[model samples]
Target chain A: MIGFETLLRWLDLAGIAVFAASGALVASRKQLDLVGFMLIAAVTGFGGGTVRDLLMGRTPVFWLRDPALLAVASAVGVLVFFTAHRIENRFRALLWADAVGLALYAVLGAEIALVGGVAPWAAVLLGVATATFGGVLRDVVCNEIPLLLRKEVYALAALAGAAAFVLLRMHGIWRDTALLAGMALCLAIRAAAIARGWSLPAYAARRD
Target chain B: MIGFETLLRWLDLAGIAVFAASGALVASRKQLDLVGFMLIAAVTGFGGGTVRDLLMGRTPVFWLRDPALLAVASAVGVLVFFTAHRIENRFRALLWADAVGLALYAVLGAEIALVGGVAPWAAVLLGVATATFGGVLRDVVCNEIPLLLRKEVYALAALAGAAAFVLLRMHGIWRDTALLAGMALCLAIRAAAIARGWSLPAYAARRD
Candidate 1:
């Protein structure tokens, strides 16, 4: 049987790999060079966790502890850089890949905070941050309007997952069970949102 | 003798306040709500330090322990929200205010890293990150091109200051003297860059 720690680490790695690929895909579309691909992929892979770690006071950062995470990201960046032209529907592929990362990261981020002794509310916020902030960084670097600034179900989906984690833990559910449930809930919502073109209300300011 | 720690704290606070104001001004330009103003200001005020501390392994985050930083940012947000229209030459004022924050934060961030046992080279990078990242965050949230991403000498100025800090410290220069010199170097460089319209070359990618 795989230890829970090993399982979690694998889950985290998978999330990072997918997110890095998504970021690199965006970089490819922008005609960024290898440096841009590498940088964007690393940032998109680690951005959310970096913000969460900073806020949660987890120092030296997760990526710093594990060099392999960055290696995976760079490898993914290289792969995408060479193969992007062969891939059709890059936009749809990016969305689906991002959704996978979003779901996993939302749950993993909250677990990190809870393990670090943060309060439940703060944990939930960290989770949402972890799931969303990376994409925010990617979009900003690519000069795209950030997803957070748009009226989207993106952040809300992460929030729902985070809240579910907290609620489940409060109800004395097993952490493993709670984790999977949270991930599933987020994934389902996000998948549905994509399938249905769901969105939150956009804020329209008065010209005057 | 005046303690270096106390002086740096005050310098950091001054930088935070100014950066917060700059961020709020952007929010006002966008006609954001109070919440938007507060968030942007706070992010601008503390974003650099937060990143620095996380990298340096300083936990609990500085502003979390001391509420004054957030309070200062929020106050600045309110002030800007009401007075933005009254201010003449906001674009010019923003450039100057940002210059002040950049100089102070450059030195302060380097100092934090040095005190936290960071290597000098890494400390210099941290310093540049600390000085420039708040503005980067502010621009991203404001939907503008980040100054760092542009062909500007902004980050170069911070890099100069951080290098000065490390050099001075290495030479056994008095902490206060070193700090002042570093800030001066950064400010002068940035001021000259602005006045002369000096810029770095933008990267052009090859399609092949």
Candidate 2:
């Protein structure tokens, strides 16, 4: 059986790859230059975790300390840049990849915060940070409103997952089992919401 | 004599105003809607410190618990949107306002980090966060390379100011004197850099 730390590391890697692919696809859609594409990929892959770590006062952010993540992201960026045209449906790919990244990050972030001794509420906030900040940075660079704030279930799903993890822990559940369960729950909810166009009600009055 | 806490409060307020103005100007240039403009202003004014506080394990980020800062930033956004044309030469105004904001934030961030029991090096990093993250976010939203990563001595100036404060404290300087000196130094260096077009060496090299 894989150690919990190793599993978390793998999930982080997968999250990075998924985010890089999504960002590179967006850059390709915009016909951005190679440098721009690389920048977007880097930001999308590492921005959220970096922000969370910085907030948590974790020194030497993961990517800065580990060159492997950057190498992998760069390689993925190059591959995506060249093969972007082969993808038949960019929007669908982006949405699916982004959802995967969001779920993975949400779990990783909450787990880290729990280990770091943060309160359950703060851990949930960190989970949201991990899931949403990268996409926020990507949208900012793409010059658009962050999709996280667009009446979507993106951040809300992450928060729910984090809450589930916290509740399971409080109930003395096994750590690894709780994490996996919470992550699976978040991914299923997010995917279903996206497929059905489910969203929370906006604060404004609804005409219908 | 003004109390130390009172001085810090005033500097924090000034930093918010300057940061909001810079963000509002950028939003105006980008032709963002009122919500977009307010969002930019709020992020620019509080994003860095919020990140810093979260990292330091401080609960309830400064602006989140205090609505006044958000209100002020929104007001500034509205004012800038209406007066954008009148404030024609935005470049000059942005430079000066950004410099003031950077200096004030550097001092405030360092002070907050110290109060939170962070190390000197970490305090300096917080200072840079307070001074530079807003501009970085603004540039990202404007779809440009971050000014800190491009032309300008922005982040470097913040670092220098932070180091000065740390050194003064090490040498037993009064806290107020150290803060004022550091802030003044940052303001002078940043303002002069902008006025004279001084910049750090670009990463590119001359092709032989």
Best by lDDT: 1
Cα lDDT for residue B123, model 1?
A: 90
Question: Pairs clashing in candidate 1?
Answer: none
Q: Can you give the TM-score per candidate against the true fold?
A: 0.62, 0.59
lDDT of 1 by residue, A1-208 (tens): 3698798788788899888988888898899999899999999999999988877777778999989999999998898889988754567876887788898999889988888987677688689889988987998778885656453577778889988988899899998899989998999999999999987533233333
Candidate 1: deviation at residue B26, Å?
2.6
- For residues B1-57, what per-residue lDDT tens digits would candidate 1 score against the true structure? 557778777877778889998887777666665555666888888888887887777
lDDT minimum window of 10 residues, candidate 1 chain B? B81-90
Q: Distance (Å) between predicted and true CA of A47, model 2?
A: 1.5
Model 2 alpha-carbon drift over 4 Å, by segment: A3-10, A88-90, A201-208, B1-45, B48-208
- Give each model's whole-structure lDDT: 0.82, 0.78
How big is the RMSD of model 2?
A: 8.0
Residue-pair clash count for candidate 1: 0
Model 1 ranges off by over 4 Å:
A1-10, A55-57, A88-90, A143-145, B1-42, B48-57, B63-136, B140-208
TM-score of 2: 0.59
lDDT minimum window of 10 residues, candidate 2 chain A: A199-208
For residue A154, model 1's alpha carbon misses the true position, in angstroms, by: 1.2
